[model samples]
Target: MNLILKLIAGIVAGILVGLYVPLTGVELLYTVKEIIGQLLTFTIPLIILFFIASGIAGLPKGSNHLLGKTVGFAYGSTIIAGTLAFMLVSAIIPLFDGGLTFNAEVATPLSNLINLKIPPLMDVMTALASAFIFGIGISQLQLETLKKVSDQGRDIIDALLAKVIIPALPFYIAGVFAEMTVAGTVFETLQTFGVVLVAALVMHWLWLSVLYISTGVLLKRNPIELIKNMLPAYFTALGTMSSAATIPISLRASKANDVQEDVANFSVPLCATIHLSGSTITIVTCAMAVMFLSPSMDVPSLVDMLPFIMMLGVVMIAAPGAPGGAVMSALGLLTSMLGFNDSAVALMIALYLAQDSFGTACNVTGDGVIALWVDRFSKKAGS
Candidate 1:
């Protein structure tokens, strides 16, 4: 909540500065944006590598059946949510403004005062491949030593995110807006993004309704009652802005839905880590908006976006436990798959962080659905 407030403050301050400040001041702001952008880019691969590797290696070896079912459900849910967002946003977003497009003519251009670049140790794909190879090998071979290393590496990256990246985000965003304001596009940008944010929130609830209704029909349960049971978890997650932090309430809610205790215990925690359908929806929606708004980028067709959504489900594994962690996990994909530039990525981070609490609430609530399904399947296998 503090982070969101701080981000709002940053946006307001940047806009004020851009309105009143001289060119040098705006240039200074752009410099800050540039440096922070470099640091964020450098961290993206490491976040993907360590987090995914540690998550995979840390899985409980004995619960293969439960784990496989849970992961499959989580991934399928995420992909479907992303796809749905892409289709809906593609159709509906155009109706909002008859399609918003950036006009580069009136834009005042600002450049970084200092040209600095920090490259990643490995590219996103390389980091992803290496993480999978080492993670699977460590898990299969019982390589405790490498597993410990991956865990430590994950901890290190988590710290950097919590301490550095999260804190720096407001200023990065402020700079982004300041540059836009100077270009005379900030007000239009804000108007369009306000619509985008509302659309994203609507999509979150829409997807949640889809999940519970599908689960209700399949399990022959009242979807409303199930949603009612999960409301406490949803509100808790909105406050905490964290799926992991809301797991306790989520477990209680799942159990209240008559999910078996053991399944709730296993699936709630695992879903907290892997089931990011809500976050995926927001990312896809925001990514599409960014593409539509950017002159340098083009909106992708559903076919072009499917592969990104598939890889996004994998990249989102064990996202760092911090505010905006899902977007942090997804930055690489936005850049690599969608060709998001620095400004596009910054807009994405800002737009995502603004409504992050809602997304987390959605994620936590949806975990109960996975728990119910997993419980039913586990019992069937036992019978």
Candidate 2:
């Protein structure tokens, strides 16, 4: 049973249940969604703290300088991907502007079956801060013990993914869509943002092509061959909708393309955190669609978005490489800076989740391209 297929099954099953199955007296099903969302929330801070810290810390001290160049290229590509999606979605959305409204029903909050308390790491700033502190600190000191500890921290998260989260995703996804169906927001969101989604997928591919085509030319490797070899990673990301989850697949693909193990190791994990080309595309496009639909808000001009997109490009560096991570990163900005109401934020969530897989596919595939460029630069310097 392919994991992707199983997840797809969960999505389909959930939609069927949400639409056809009676929601009467089905409190347990609703709880399933809540727990999974909580688990994802729990997973984000730890993964960010550990994955970033360990990834940066693991690099050799002299090699640490490469971080600057790597981040530059990664951020540059992410902005390009976001801008492309923003332009394409902006152009296409007016055609679908039949003025769809989100008629979300008021729903009761589900009560917890059991009271359980975990101390919160709710501050993303704290996570980002700790990641940089521990990562840079360990790199400078080269503390073997601390490296081992950080590795263990990442291992613990992996256990959570394999044992708890991964196995539970189908149910989680089903529960999510099912809840959306009950709330009556999913279909309407889809109706309005379908064009945005198509635009996002198209941009995801275009940006990926831009990356590989450039790297392919630089390395003198056939770009088509590079892309063909990465199909496994792409499909894996598409199914998982998570760059962190697809790291192994992306690394494997990079190695197959002759990326040095050191580069692949350092690049893939770091890229998972910072290389969010696909996710940004979806976020920008979805945010624009939500604003346009809401009537009170109009989408910002590209000039207005310059600073915001620059900030978004940086903020995404701290974004967890998990499903829905990009939107969560954008949530604060959209609400505070962009004046999005609760309804608009909710629409953004639904819209981003709906197209999360494609964005993730774009993200993980792009990781391989970055690895190629990094690998080439490393060899050039070594020579």
Candidate 3:
């Protein structure tokens, strides 16, 4: 069966067990779940650092202008997505003023499992700064050995994704839902999450349409036909829910859309790492909806939130392409920077995971648009 199906089955089974399984006090499932969660978190910081650096180093030494344009445009698209989510969710939320409050109990023995953290020398923001310098610095200095090391680090991350992380995701998902069901918060909170999910999906479509319309005007191709070519990537991401996993497919789709080989290779993987428009939109929307509904929380004023939204846009660029990677990376910011209580953070996790596949579909699809844009711009610059 498909990986997505397996994951969905895990979710379904976990919810059922949580809701009906007579294993309420069972420590086995909870223990396993916490262990898996810790493992995934363990890989995130290093993976982000290495992946960003490797993607930077992957660009041709002579292609500094292309690199700048690619990064600039990718960051621009993400900003559009984050802002769009904020707008759409804010406008639509008054129509349904419903809220969710979660006072759920974490499963015991497993809840006792310690979070094994190996923090980076600096936090996420600092790590990205360091990565940018080292990644770009190595390329300019012609340090082939360090470049080789970055490539190896990227490979190790790839192995972790395929052999370890992806394989374990279903069980991890099951444990999450099961715990929620046991706590009796699943049904009510999911209702609020549903509203956030719909808003995020609509914003995703809007951003993709904007991307394709711009492509049509600049690149002089039928936007519909271009969108059609990208559908395969979108669908692949829908199933895998991992842009990193879908990179190979996304690259193939971009090539078929007539993106030049050099542009496709550098932009697809780099965009997969950096282009998290859909995920950011979904997170922002979900976080907002949850905040609106919770009595103890109020969605911060826009002026207060503007800096956060901007920082969040960049911070999420480091989000790995794993299933719950964006939220996992954003956890610290959500709690510390945004003042989300434990309950709010828990709600964010559920909401983010619920709609992650659609966000990923939007993300990989947008990569095609970015690739098309970069190709047109690079040609003009060269001319």
Candidate 4:
């Protein structure tokens, strides 16, 4: 919540500076944005490699079937949520406005004082592939040494995100808006930001309804009661803005929803890592909005968007615990798959961070749904 407030302050400060301050001042902000942007690019692949490798390799052994079921369920939910968001946002955004075009005549060009370049050790796809290979090998072969290494790498990256990147985001975002304000397009962009945020929030609840109702019908349980039991976890996530941090409440809530104690213990923690349907929805929605608002990009067709959605589900498995981690994790996909430029990516970060807590709340609440399903499936198999 403090993070959200700080981000709001950043946006307001940037807009004020752009409107009133000298070009030199706004250039300073732009320089900060450039430096932060380059740093983000450098760390994205490392975040993907270490977090995904650690997540996969650290899966509890001796529960192979349960592990498979949990992962399958989590991935499926994420993909479906992302695809659904694309469909809904695509259909709706076009009805309101075709696109938001920047006024080149009114736009003021800003330059960074320092052009620093920091390259990543590997590209996003290579990191993903390497992580999967090493992760599966470590898990299947019981390689404790490599597993420890991956875990340590994950810790290092996690600290980098939590301490450095997350703290710097507000200034990074301020720089983005400051540039937009100078370009005279900030107000138009702000209008679209509000609409897209509302749309994303509505879709979050809508997807939650779909998940719990479907789970209830399949298991012959009261969906409302189950959802009611999960409300504490939902509210907790809104405060923590992290699924992992909300796991304790989620565990109690899942048990209240009648998920077996053992299953809740296993699935809640695992789902915190892998089940990110809510984050996927926000990312997909925000990505589409950024495309519509950017002249350099176009809103993708269903065929084009499907591949991104699929990749998004996989990439989300690597999202760190930092605020706005989902957007950070998906940055590689946005750039490589969707061709998001720096300005577009900056808009995505701003839009996503605005409603990060709501999305996280949905993520943790939906974990209970997964817990219930896994419990039922495991019970039937045992019987």
Candidate 5:
């Protein structure tokens, strides 16, 4: 009940702020939104790193197969799902007549998508180091020695995030919407391309549902029952728009859907960290739209851009932690690899924010379905 109330309050507050922003002016909205965006940007990497490293470290040694299979399936499905989404959008967008062309003022250099500037080797080493530290730290602590203390840490983090951090989100969202609204940007920005945007979002949702259904069929599980069982988690994801935040509810839903407890416990945390179907789709769709819109560049043939699109998908998987990480990464790929301009990147960011919630819901739903499939497969192998 409390969760429901909080969600309702957040929505109502967000709408009110979005509506009020134009009346107030763009400067205030931009300032407020930028501040909030910066804070979120800062928190994202730390939270993701700790959450992933600790979770991986904490997994019991014997649980590697379950973990490995679950992660592998998630990554594979996300890549396939992203590619299918891109093809669907590519085919559908051309029907919208001249279809979302970009203004010349914003064009900049496109980056190479395949040759990512990998993070420093030290950062990778740090992640591994942190994982070991966390794993060993937990393993050494006797359950009786730290049970209550452990619970305290969990409770504190939960309270801080839920009570303090989350309530502020609507304000931030309002500020962003307001800035866009006041700039007379909403219609001009989305103008003529609303259909394409809608089509892309729908395709994302459809592909996610397809992934779930395919997994169900493969596992001999009832697809409708799978959807029904995951409703609480789905709704939670819809409201929160953060897969990391939705992990607990997703785990609960997986258990309800008959996933084994050990599998649920291991897979949900990993999925929350790395499973990003929604983000991947948003990045690709937005990037493509921007490319089509840009007036300066000779639009690359779809066949020509296929390699870059696939590379963008992989880069975005590692992007959840960076501020504007996904969009920046996509933009970098476009400019450095594909020769797209900066205007395209800006437009991509603007368009993507509009449909981010839908993308997040798709991501969480796919995670639940994958967890079920992994559990079923493991059971079969054991038998």
Candidate 6:
């Protein structure tokens, strides 16, 4: 009921903004929206840090096998789902006939820095090293009482995201939309490549369905039952478009799929923090499209950038944890690695935000599926 009201509020607010903004000529509205977005970007990192630290602290000590299986399944399944989705979308893009041409005018410039040429191998190593250091630090902080306090902190943060951050999303989205609409950014690009947009969205749905079905089959569970169990989480993610916001529902679905409580607690939060199948897929697909559309753009070859792409996908898991942080992170990668200008980043943002809900839904569903497989493997191994 609360979720429904939130959705309704977002839609109503969006409609109101859509209606009144043009008439009011509110020049400051976009500026205000950007400010709110910037605030979110700032908040997301703390949210991620606290959530991860607390979740790691709370994990049961004796559940290494369960944790291992769950983490492996989640990472493996995310890669599979992302690859399949990419393939499906790649195939479908040809059918769109959307007359989409990439315009370099949409590219954004990397701010005030000489392009530093970092080797892709070193870049990937740096990311892994950072993750390892964070993991080791969390592992060392294993005091039970501290864990409890951290868990409580996480709960409070979750409440804030749900009650406050989420409620503000629609307004932010509206502001983004209004700004884009006014700037002629929303419709102009999409109008030419509307088919590509639709194709990408459809591919998201198809891959999500495939992931759910695959989870059922792998776990020897009923597909319909799995879907039924996960529907609440799916809808929650769809509405919130934030996996962190949907964590509570995802934990519920994890349990419903027979994942042990200890394992579910550890894995679900970790997955929410790092397992960004939907976002990764969207970034790659969109980047590919941008490359294809802009023939003159000297984009890095896929073979040359594959390592970076994978690393970017992993780093992006840290993105949603910070408010509005993903864009900056993506821009960093695009400008530094892919040579994308600000216009390209803006267009990518437009494409990504327009279909973020579907991507989010996919991410949530993939998390649940991986949880189920992990639970089944744990049980079998114990037997």
Residue-level lDDT tens digits of model 6 in 236-302: 9877877889999999988987778876787787677667777667776777677666655754554
lDDT agreement with native, every candidate? 0.89, 0.72, 0.74, 0.89, 0.59, 0.60
Task: Give per-residue CA lDDT, model 1, range 326-360, as digits (tens).
Answer: 99999998889998877678788889999999999
Provide backbone clash counts, one per model: 1, 0, 0, 0, 15, 16
Pitting candidate 3 against candidate 4, the one with the higher TM-score is 4
User: Which run of 10 residues does model 3 get worst, by summed lDDT?
Assistant: 103-112
Model 2: per-residue lDDT, tens digit, 16-66?
777787555234666776666666556656766776687678754555546
TM accuracy, model 6: 0.66
Q: Candidate 6: list runs displaced more than 4 Å.
A: 1-62, 94-98, 106-131, 134-188, 298-302, 322-328
Best candidate according to lDDT: 1
Give candidate 4 misplaced runs (Cα > 4 Å).
98-108
TM-score of 2: 0.70
Model 6's lDDT to the true fold? Answer: 0.60
Model 1 has an lDDT value of: 0.89
Q: How close is candidate 3 to the true structure, as a TM-score?
A: 0.78
Candidate 4 per-residue lDDT over residues 110-144, each given as its tens digit:
98799899998999999999999999999889999
lDDT of 3: 0.74
TM-score of each: 0.97, 0.70, 0.78, 0.96, 0.64, 0.66
- How are the candidates ranked when ordered by lDDT, highest leading? 1, 4, 3, 2, 6, 5
Residues 337-365, model 5: lDDT tens digits: 66653334334554555566677777788
Residue runs of model 5 more than 4 Å from their true location after superposition: 1-61, 107-188, 298-306, 321-331
